[model samples]
Target: MIPRFNDHAANERTYLAWVRTAIAVMAFGFLVERFDLFITYASQNASRAAHKLHMHLRLTEWVGLLLIVFGALIILLASARFLRNRRDIAHERMEDYAGPVGEKLLAAILVLLGLFLVVYVGQELAALSSQPDM
Candidate 1:
């Protein structure tokens, strides 16, 4: 039997959880990016003047792309961490990983993203409220 099989299995399970999270993030990003298609379709029937008036930057696409990139980074970082932990376990020198640096960074990033999204939504609402009725 492999030495410390349970420890290795636990490490692998953690790695898989990270992988699942990464995939979820990427999928959400893709959904956000696809909103552009909906916007385009909605604008198709608009008059030229209306089209010109409604034209705006695709912020969602950029945010979605950033999310996808962040997810990919998470996957890479998680793999590296998993390997390091496995090595440590093999050598019987495992250290406590209570909130590792990478996880802390990810949490910080998520907090920032949440704040940015809140501010962005506020700005959009304010803009809509200030616009003159058509």
Candidate 2:
């Protein structure tokens, strides 16, 4: 078998980097959602404008939550794969690698994620268009 060349340190570093990115995304999402909640509260205290403001705030919260969950899951799965690859490399069992199955699955997941983003954007745009002028 070919000698293992996978650097555990480098792989670990990459995994940590991804984790940090995931944390950042989650934090940002939480902040955005919280901001929306604050807006909702403020609108409730306000006059007639509260209804529209609440709608906008709800949309923001939903979008933010979706993005945060998606990002976190992606990072988690990527990190898991990276660690698995590193382990396989260390064992010098490169031949037993996910040769085709893993690749196909990864591709499918990426495509699904792309489609989801496209649909989400389209829906957001549609909602915006349907709303009255602010």
Candidate 3:
């Protein structure tokens, strides 16, 4: 069996890496959402002729918020997985190697995540289509 310390260290490092990625994703999501919101507010206070432009800006802000929410969800799931995987690796028993339930679960989760992303993109596209042309 692999040594516990080595495996634990590796697992911790992997978890930390994932955490970093999650932070980046969340930060970028926030930036996108915030910038869009600023544009929306600015356009809203402008002249009446810019009403259509304001509508488009509002739509864009909504899209940005959706992206932020998606990213946040992804980060939450990824962090949970990383912690679970680290725990499994750190305390792995002989029986765990045989059935590998954790690995299987992780695989299942990844598949679900992919499906979620696909559905999310599709929904966003549908929403975009419902918007009036600007």
110 Cα displacement, candidate 1 (Å): 1.4
Stretches of candidate 3 off by over 4 Å are 1-3, 37-49, 94-134
TM for every model, in the order presented, reads 0.73, 0.57, 0.50
Model 3 agreement with the true structure over 76-128: per-residue lDDT tens digits: 76678667767676667432443656447646755665465467546545655
* Candidate 2 C-alpha lDDT tens digits along 1-134: 33544466677777787677677667766775676665555444444355666676776688669658956885878678787878766875645545666447646755764576467547545655565555
lDDT of 2: 0.65
Question: For residues 96-134, could you state the per-residue lDDT of candidate 1 as single tens digits?
Answer: 765767778888987887787678657645655565655
Candidate 3 residue 66 C-alpha distance from true site, Å: 2.2
Local error of candidate 2 at residue 91 (angstroms): 2.0
What shift in Å separates residue 91 of candidate 3 from its native position after superposition? 3.1
Which 10-residue window of candidate 1 scores lowest in summed lDDT?
Answer: 48-57
Q: Give per-residue lDDT, candidate 3, residue 8.
A: 72
Best by TM-score: 1
